[model samples]
Target: MDRVIIAGGGWSGCAAAVQAKKEGADVTLLERTDMLLGTGLVGGIMRNNGRFTAAEEMIAMGGGELFQVIEENLKHKHISFPGHEHGDLYDIGKISGAVFRFLKEMGIHIYTKSRVLHAQMKDRRMINVTDAEGNCYSGDGFVDATGTAGPMNNCSKYGNGCAMCILRCPSFGGRVSLTSLAGVQEKMGRRPGGAVGSMSGSCKLYKESLSLEIQERLGRDGVAVVPVPPELVEDHLEKKSCQQYALPEFRENLVLLDTGHGKLMTPYFPLEKLQKIPGFENARYEDPYAGGKGNSMRYFAMAPRDNTLNVEGVDNLYCAGEKSGLLVGHTEAIVTGVLAGHNCVRRIQGKQQIILPDTLAIGDIISYVKQEMDTPEGMERKYTFSGSFYFQRMKEKGLYTTDTALIQKRVEEAGFSRYFSHSGKKDCVS
Candidate 1:
């Protein structure tokens, strides 16, 4: 069997491992922290706006196992909030463990606290990757899902001094990129005003800390939109990585979602100011611990890769999630991860790696983001299926739809029905 080593056990890495394993490859996933999910440990929004279409398309293509897992653990489904509709909020508290178990059951070897610190390369191909503890993993192909979040230094340099976000870099020794270790030149995403990086758009607030009325609303309806005082609203829209939530409504109101924690839909809010609100008198941040000041910084290191997700100039390296581009959201990561993983196995089998055709939203975004990243303006913009620029583009291209049958038909027409469901074992190319 071909051994595939994946660095960074975020949602993208997990999806890649599952896909590669389904293709009959022996897969190993590494994470810097003790837990999986990376940024997804705090993110729970799924199937919002065009994300719904993208999720259905992946399901039709037989690469929806991760989505299914998320759906199974949903805290709320078919819920609507400002600028987003038909959204599902997964239980952030439960999802990482669920996904961890799912990947383990799929037979993918998982190593928590195994941060890839160095790569051994022969010519342009990576021969092996060594973890922080000096343990090394050898593989036929590699996927760099090391997300662009933080190593604390980037956060301090580009963002407010370590808001202590979920990445927990201080404890885990920061995120190390396999692409950088393999000597690939990586790219940094820019904010709207040409800032080096963007702040993670949301923070988690402790549910019990909120007042009973606010807690009841969140518990019953999956959302609570509390009006913020005009004087208390802080404008940090331009600094947000999730541009989808950068709207006037978000600025005027405190939009909280029930994702196990009260998911605050803003980069950060002053604790003093938040306490002044009626239902938030006792509200407190859960994840960042310092959400009153800032959140984690992201898009500091993205790999340069082709539309097929193969890292340029590297023979056996692929990338996904934020590492692949400035993609946001869990659905985006899962789709790209599935492609990267499937392609890694194809590279090992000496078969032509597949490119998702433009007919599908997944294929279109993969190609679109790569094209946009080459330009200055595109680098400043974040892409996700949910809303903002990409969702508008999806609408313009007639790619966003809720019709499940139509989505399945489109996938079948693209010759991608069950594409990632391959179980055959192929002889290693070399």
Candidate 2:
């Protein structure tokens, strides 16, 4: 029996474990936290990426047939709230819960509150891992779906900064990070349709350092800012232990603050100092995740891009979902998880490799990450807008996938085209 060990039980970790088990590998998942707090670890930021739409035309004409197929399998419905406009929000927690249920149904061993301390590597191959409780576990192949690339971090700390690359600049284009708050009023009053007020207030600011200034200006209009910062933005973060905080999850009719900036933007400075900023005062503490402080960063929270998934030094170990570090949203995470899962199984069986949809941006994303690590010389690294720069590299490789085209198409279809314009000179996916 092939034994496989997985670290972290968040979306990515759970997805990976399920996939590995399906492939006939005995999978063990280690989650540092005891219970699954679907509640917002930091102000329910996970609940609101808003609605990200891909172009239906592209999805149809392109090789992205799987995109449509998987999306159709997902459940979506219009939810109404008092004093707010009701729109379709994908029940992401449900999707994650489904995976967890599937894992349990399969009889996989799930270890909660067991923190994997370190991996014992022999000849650069991971042989065993030690947890916080002094329990030593070994496996045939280890799936490091640890959001912050936990195993890779241990390896890099002892070895050279191998298996990962941390971009220092806070202003990565594709990524953004911001805090949000709830407890606001509906301005438009109640309408017959559902609610007259908007469900969420969008944050216009882009920079991490200017987050407070931007929030102050926006919050004055009844908008709240959730305080979720990237670890790189905080100075004391690297030195001090992680500060855990309890956060409230949104249920029916829950008002949430804007987290557009804090969750997506990469932090320029150390993220620890940002918590000490003026706005985050009186923020209470909650449960901590397995990977600690760095993993909690908004950018990392979106999705991780550790070199584990990339075709590099290691051969047997395969990564997927948020742990892949390239995926940002739930749909992408699940899709990639499926792809990685299917492909890893096929590869083990010595069958043909599963080729990703080249037409879709997601496909290009995985390929681009592989290319980024290939040269290692003067990689034009910049966080333009979340992971947009990576997509831009894919463009250079002849892939014309952009969130703008897809998002704009949806906006136009929804009769809100004017709200988004290319002429504004401010690129959403810059």
Which residue window of length 10 is worst by lDDT in model 2? 177-186
lDDT of 1 by residue, 234-256 (tens): 89888999999999999999999
Q: Candidate 1 vs. truth: CA RMSD?
A: 2.0
TM-score of 2: 0.46
* Model 2 deviation from the true structure expressed as Cα RMSD, one decimal place: 16.7
- Can you tell me which runs of candidate 1 are displaced by over 4 Å? 423-430
Worst 10 residues of 1 by lDDT: 421-430
Best candidate per TM-score, number? 1
Report model 1's TM-score to 2 decimal places.
0.98
Per-prediction TM-score, please?
Answer: 0.98, 0.46
